[model samples]
Target: MRHAHTVEQVRAAEAELAGQPLMDRAVAGLAATCARLLRERRGRVYGSRVLVLAGSGDNGGDALFAGAALARRGAAVSAVLLSPEKAHRAALAALRATGGQVTTDQNVGLADFARADLILDGIVGIGGRSGLRPAAAPYATAPRTGLLVAVDLPSGVDADTGEVAGAALRADLTVTFGTHKPGLLIDPGAGHAGPVQLVPIGLRPPAAPVQALQHADLAALLPRPGAESDKYRRGVLGVRAGSERYPGAAQLVVAGALHGGAGAVRYLGRPGAEVVRRHPEVLLGDGRVQAWVVGPGSGEATVEALDATLAAEVPVLVDADGLTELARRGPGALAGRTAPTLLTPHTGEAARLLGGAATAERCAAARLRTARELADRYGATVLLKGSTTVVARPDGTARVNPTGTSWLATAGSGDVLAGLAGALLAAGLDPFDAASAAAYLHGLAGRLAAAGGNRLPFGSVHSTVGDRGEAPVTARQVAAALPAAWRNATAPQGGSQQDAAGLGD
Candidate 1:
């Protein structure tokens, strides 16, 4: 059961629970939780201490209640009140009754903070609008500190936008109640919500306003070969990409499509001609294709060929220049078509299509809004690509891809992503699944390509290209790495297939 919720939605759910007659019934449940933590950290130094830095709202109330529980488990417990007179009366009373100390001395608090086994940051939650105020700022994660945990949501993170506010605490583990906020899964705000885990808090967010990707779901949605399947029946991705100027994009996107399980990839365009020259199996021009992958390096994408793509209409992946043209004139020119439309656009193209403010730094909230708005406006699936790629449904279920890797910051990668998405669309997966799986697998592939390298992370990022050298892989390298990446990312029971060893075949 996966759930994604916005801040206001989560807050409303928690508020309703608090209004229940049995609200205090679970106040003592914190002690049981602390005992479990104690069992998990048995042999480590500073294992027994739990610091609760609390504020004034129910968010702070959760920490104080938990602090009392830690005290009962023989761990030294302390609650440092940021707001002197405004702490939750009931929760503070519980902490005091359990012998948890409330200290006023700054030095003593600092010492407790430094030597503390774990820090429970209940300083703020979904209710937080500003940032770490003057009082709560001091305890933010420093270069050296113990594991930090958050309650409900991390302080200084916009639970809706996935944007970090003035000062955010970087948590090692955030134990949130009920469901995950959008910030916990997407970038920027995701940076601060490290390794989030949700605690069942007996309340459900309304409307299911947001969502996140998961591996098993991707695996299930991915196209797989069955009986009576042939190369043509499965799907053919006609790739129109690359040029003399960008000859590499054709190879990389094709590598991606091949690994993506496309039955056949029919190469097209001037770049497609070059791709057929390199890989003799690739056919030139269009034939019968279940999907079309257009605009990889299409600096000179002809209006005639693009029109053929629109006319085919099985499932179309619009990338690079194709994405740019679609953004400007709209895919409405492809009007009166019945096949699904998939548009994969980087941040700039998405911003242009949506006709609004944009930034490489724009939070997930804005991207999500853009995706939904564009899907509705253009009548297609909008895979808005970025550090946190978002795939939205016209039906209101938008999923943020969870698998991300920094090594994916290479050129030509988007083309390969477009290919993978196109193959899935042709193989008959839902638009939402096809786009999200493509983004997730693209990132996983980058990790595999650079698996055992130095600061390069995935592998030798500076290798040479020759008979004796391994070219520093471009997007094609990542696409070539897909099957292996998927194996490493999704192989169950600690086992793997050895069919692939490097980024490329």
Candidate 2:
């Protein structure tokens, strides 16, 4: 994973760098790099004139300096001073010297803001808290003219808390200085920053981190089975899910697991062994497994089945009915596991698991805290799935899966996810990837499933949205669509994306 520095860590690095006289030149050099990016993309930069929304501090300084560099490249760059006399004097002066002017007149500024090629937000940084000052407040969510490049972070985002204050500007890109701040990594704040561009400013060694993940870096850490692998060697997954009342749960979970790349999946509980009747490939009565998935559609009687699954010497994925049992057991049962355990609880289950914690607090902080507190209590990885999925480990460095579409709130979907995740663990992927990839693909599957399915996340992917969409998506249809999802995630570049018809759009 890419190492991320917290706000304090970046500040210490800045202090050390700023202590050296050469650091000033380095600051200019970094500014020059941003200027170069602007210069090379000038037409796009100005076909969009750069509107620099300058605030009171160094964030504004960076923007004004960037404006100066943009002006030098023939792009019309103007700064709208929010703090008036309190603006960064040196950078403002430098911008003025380079023919980049500041305008305080509201009408004229608003007009320019409406038709600009790009707007550079210098309104806030790591030093700033959430909430907008009165003067610049209106622009927070107003219709923007073009792509926005935030200087450090968008205005009104708490640099430390990752919470948005009263109003916040949403940027297309944020060019962060020194190193990443906590706000640039965590959500509600991270979401506002959009994709980030980390620019080095000769910063020093790291400190306590906030958040980070590197695709290639983490990809390397994921376990892959070799050709010598066997069913037992490949890792076995035990699934104690579904019942006579809800047999599809078992089948879908099995479907998800089979494709999840597991060595073998063991069946337990009622209709589960009978699931082997149809999917006879699965062995009944778990001998041993690397991972266990229980509780999907187990309903009230799932307690015993869940208990048996939890007793294994393998990682466990607790979902649905299993989660309900886990809740009644309190957080202590997880501490007793002989193997690594993972909880795939949704918000309501999480609330039941977390007890009295406020819904917002749990939604905001539970993911990070769950892995720690629960891991410390139960020694397991906590993969809390929701609108904002957070996967935390017993070890630090919590990762938030960044890819999501609002299309995954469907019913019975969690069964597929539990199967997929358990399958990955059985297949030898680290618990982190097992959980995260399952979530990512779950969301992707939802997007594919609902493209023409009436735009409902849980309903079906079988609507007439596309004039001539190829096929309607059923459970089988969604199952068939997963290969493309896997391909997109594994593709080297931004691979050819398919439209609703499952054809290249």
The root-mean-square deviation over C-alpha atoms between each candidate and the true structure, in angstroms, is 6.2, 6.0
Q: What is the lDDT of residue 38 in candidate 2?
A: 56
Q: Provide the clash count, candidate 2.
A: 11
Worst 10 residues of 1 by lDDT: 496-505
Give one digit per residue, the lDDT tens place, for model 1 in 1-505.
2567876786677677776633343344434544555567665323388788888878888888878767766667898888768788888998899788897665666678887777788788687873688667776744435567777677888787676657788776676666778777666666677666556658766877676545555566677688999988788888777777777777777877888878888887666666766666676765888888777776765455567787785787777877777766764765676887788877777766666566435524466666777778788888988767878777767888765456566787887788788877777777778898888777667655655321123322211112122224467668777886565545562112221211111
**What lDDT would each prediction earn against the true structure?**
0.69, 0.67
Q: What ranges in model 2 sit over 4 Å off?
A: 19-48, 104-108, 207-215, 218-223, 360-379, 428-430, 440-505
- Best model number under TM-score: 1
Ten residues in a row with the worst lDDT in model 2?
496-505
> Alpha carbon lDDT of residue 372, candidate 2?
48
